[model samples]
Target: GAGVSQSPSNKVTEKGKDVELRCDPISGHTALYWYRQRLGQGLEFLIYFQGNSAPDKSGLPSDRFSAERTGESVSTLTIQRTQQEDSAVYLCASSFRGREQYFGPGTRLTVT
Candidate 1:
């Protein structure tokens, strides 16, 4: 499989709207992670997935953000009631041992 891929490379939506971002990690990789990078900040961890389970989600900034994956396949991150502050580049990474990771281009979300 390719390194990593993300869909809807860019997105713009009104406040309170909802959006879903998708990520496809390399084949055979069991570790997936979601992060967010604002205009001028480093990536902030959002969620981590091992296989189909997420044991830690303490990095989630709010309850409005959620993520799920299917047995090491594709993963989706949904943002509900999107806010201007939610506008950022959503980054996805995958790894075999959960150490060295490959990253996707990221989905750019903009809320007006």
Candidate 2:
């Protein structure tokens, strides 16, 4: 069984540019989540999707951030107009209901 995965593993871009990060969740998992961790900060939820439920995007920092998941599987997070403040590790996780979430290594985004 595949665990959650994310890539570029690392990203470097200039401020105001855009970046797209991808995630692949484990099979049969009905719930997916995205989080961002700034230096020395705990993981902050960015979005969550469960089955057909409406995605919870309340944690997205701004309109520049968005994500899409297809059939509880792969998901991509796009950050438009990236800013230096957006530099952080973006992590993806998946879980079955009431189970521990499995986390991806994360995409480290650096904006300069």
The best candidate by lDDT is 2
Report the lDDT tens digits of candidate 1 across residue range 8-89: 8999999999999999999999999999999999999998998756447889999999888988889999999999999999
Residues 1-112, candidate 2: write the lDDT tens digits. 6678899999999999999999998888899999999999999999999998899999999999999999878999999999998999999999997389999999999999
Model 2 error, position 3 (Å) = 1.5
TM-score of each: 0.95, 0.96
80 in model 1: Cα distance from truth in Å?
Answer: 0.3
Q: Which runs of model 2 end up more than 4 angstroms from their true locations?
A: none
Structural RMSD, model 1: 1.1
Q: Least lDDT summed over 10 consecutive residues: which range in candidate 1?
A: 49-58
Off by over 4 Å in 1: none
Scanning candidate 2 in windows of ten residues, the lowest lDDT window is 93-102
> Which candidate number would show the highest TM-score if scored against the true structure?
2
